[model samples]
Target: MSLNRIASVRAVLGISLTLVLATFFFSPSYSMESRDNSSSPVAGLRVEIKQTSTSPITITSTVVNDNDHTVTFLVYNSPLDTAAPSIGLLTITPDGASEPLDLPKLQIQRQWPPSPESLIQLQPGASQTADIVLKDFIASKIAGKASVALKGRWDMVWNKQKDDVTPEMIEQAQLQAEPDVFSGSFASESVEISPA
Candidate 1:
């Protein structure tokens, strides 16, 4: 083929390839918003639990927000009046134990129609760590390897819509949000521990 003809063919191929890629990336089925809107927020978020000590079973749980927008959640704040709209009990299973130990129950005060100001923010790509207590639930614990995991439930609202929302309005909005009750679990790697 002549030099001019060859150059024209290459340009056409390049444009075609670019258009195909752009279409794929921008398509509704392949876009990020589509996934976030369709799936549970717990699936997008991640949790990692590390057994810091063996004797008392000191666990540090880290929660990661992988969504594109910021998320508002309740932290283990007062243990009394904290709003845990989307978190559930954690499960700890020893290597050979038949029954799993659950995290100690918190005296969570039920505030119907969650307070608008009590929510904590988790920015995109951010993570927060909180110390988890297992001593009360598993007293005189046997020393051995154990696996820790979190079975969490989350009620999430878009950051943009969460601000300035009133409790009265929240109840109705909760039903309309993308992910109202997202249930999922996070499994962490086993960590060695010894009785303190």
Candidate 2:
């Protein structure tokens, strides 16, 4: 082949290789649906509450990953639940009220970026339990039968070191302000809260 023809062939091969590498390495990652697409994280997950004790109610949530792929969750135990700073949301609907009342916000014990230990990973068919105290969750206004619900909003964050997180991700999560990944909202069976 002539010098020019050989040079042209090499240029085309280089370009083709570059495109293949880019498509393979720089392409978007194929991530399984982190959520069940519905407002609930998993179809089988459930929340149970015990209100026998008036001083401190006990709340337990069982999370089951029913999807075919593995999933990870960031379970934050706010100051109300634990002494650490983590992301969480809890609400209660009063017996006679139509709307559920949001849990009172406690002081953020630990500020971001969160430590690696906060990440909870679950394989398919795996389950995890989160036990929280319902002390301040149930208000005196919720007289009679009350319904409890918990919403977990953080799930989209990549499971990696804080350095791997970008400013855009932080802004998207509203990390300092609100939760970005909304796993799902779980409701517990109604329970009676006797009048004080």
Candidate 3:
């Protein structure tokens, strides 16, 4: 092949490769700009339980926000049924304790979203602390062995249209139109609890 033709082909190939790379780099799916900022699906949430007393136990968990946007935490006494759209009791097990802790009777409180209304926005690079006090729930007297397993399904919702909508009116309407996305198996473990 002629030198001139060879050089032209190489130049074209180089340009094509550069364009392809640029397109992938700028694509919304690959770019940070198009990422979802809402609460991520609770696939493998971390949980740690600690035993404070034999009569009563305290469960604290740190829910990490692994998304780019903020997410509100919603805690329910029951597991949410996604298919049927129903609510039921969540099963909880105390650390070193054989029996599972009943969730229906326990009272949960939080500062951000307010009780009877578990709603707290978790910003990117931020985490919220949730503390639950279990009555009649006791931790193991054994040191470092006292822990609880909290198993439950929590629903998560985020308004996607409100991303850049100004004046907030149109955004609100858009949010209403959007369905409330549900996530399940929001389980977590509490730090090991020991007699104080």
Best by TM-score: 1
lDDT of each: 0.56, 0.51, 0.46
- List the candidate numbers ranked by TM-score, top first: 1, 2, 3
Candidate 2 residue pairs in clash (backbone atoms < 3 Å): 153-181
Name the lDDT value of residue 168 in candidate 2. Answer: 62
TM-score of 1: 0.56
Per-residue lDDT tens digits for candidate 2, residues 1-196, read 8999999999999999999988776555412232223333344444444444555555555565665555554545421233211233666677778787644566666446555565556666776665555555344555566766555443343333334555466456754533334344444555454434
Model 2 lDDT vs. the true structure? 0.51
By descending lDDT, how would the candidates be arranged?
Answer: 1, 2, 3
Off by over 4 Å in 2: 1-55, 77-88, 136-139, 155-196
Candidate number with greatest lDDT: 1
The CA-based lDDT of model 3 is what?
0.46
Model 1 over residues 1-196: C-alpha lDDT tens digits? 9999999999999999999999999997678656655754555566666656655556676777787877665432311111221233555566788887543554666566766655556688987766665554363444566655554444433443346455655566556643332333444454544345
Candidate with the larger lDDT of 2 and 3: 2
Model 1 Cα displacement at 62 (Å)?
Answer: 1.2
lDDT of 1 at 17: 100
